[model samples]
Target: MAEIQEKADSGKGGKKRAKKMSVHLDMTPMVDLAFLLLTFFMLTTTFSKPQTMEINMPVKPDSEEDQSPLKASNAFTIILGDDDKVYYYYGLVEDKPELNTTDYSANGIRKVLISPRIKSNDKMVVLIKPMDVSRYKNVVDILDEMKITDTKKYALVDINDADKELVASKTGG
Candidate 1:
């Protein structure tokens, strides 16, 4: 709603001059409508739910006899270290696993994970060992890469002494 007021003043010669008018605008109703719309939208809209990645952890064996050995040819190991360094090997470390270094880029670890040999092997497994010096985000990113590469079998294992030594020798730690 709006209103206009007019005022008349007498000139110096006693003649009446043109009326001066001022306009006022009422914004209370408009403000109330805006608030009501905001509340309605807020109440009717649905918020996004949190997303989570599913991880399958292995169950502990009851005895040594219950454990099964994994084949070296079907294994791939990834070592995560500080400064975004990634070291990978094709098979068991006992066979003198030739450590190759790569990064987290699309053409780096992803390329290795999706290679024809690894992808075609039905029993292929990925072993991820995150060192103490590695950042939390690096672990998460590696996990995400595993998912993106659609690796069916992967495990998060501890950094062993041999692995620590290899990393130390390679990175000059």
Candidate 2:
């Protein structure tokens, strides 16, 4: 049978050599795996919405006579009473009062002042000053309001003036 098989060969050879072929891997599976990984990453990424906080930022008084430099075009003045009522006033030095409202709470101060300023001009600054005896929460509320209204330039007014010092000393400054 071996001799018959040898004779069946069309070509004569000393020793037949096996043919060699290149190996290839299918790339479709690899591409699918890459896409799956990409999808997982896309889904896992965290998207954070913007947030806000309230703070007491200081403002330089326009002059010693009155703390109204804080009332300048870029200032925001807020007074809180012992009764917990809040008095908020804001406007440019030259312009009429943009906002003046006394709320039983600090709910709408930012909505009234910050929103208007932001929509009016991107370069606007709001210097916030809370009165003495004001609740700490009032300051925080104002800051939260500013963040919501997108007020960027904000400052606190420190009571360093002579009158403020006397008042603080008398009332536990």
lDDT of each: 0.92, 0.56
Worst 10 residues of 1 by lDDT: 8-17
Instruction: Please report, as a residue range, the 10-residue window in candidate 2 with the lowest summed lDDT.
Output: 1-10
Estimate candidate 1's RMSD in Å. 4.2
User: How far in Å is the alpha carbon of 18 misplaced in model 2?
Assistant: 94
Off by over 4 Å in 1: 1-35
**Could you report the Cα RMSD, in angstroms, for every candidate shown?**
4.2, 13.6
TM-score of 2: 0.42
Candidate 2 per-residue lDDT over residues 73-133, each given as its tens digit = 5555554433455554455424434334455333455456646554576545655556676
In candidate 1, the residue pairs with backbone N, CA or C atoms under 3 Å apart (3 or more residues apart, or in different chains) clash, namely none
Clashes (N, CA, C under 3 Å) per candidate: 0, 12
TM-score of each prediction? 0.78, 0.42
Identify the candidate with maximal lDDT: 1
Candidate 1, 48-149: lDDT as tens digits: 989889888889999999988988998899999899989999998878878899999999999999999899998999999999999999999999999999
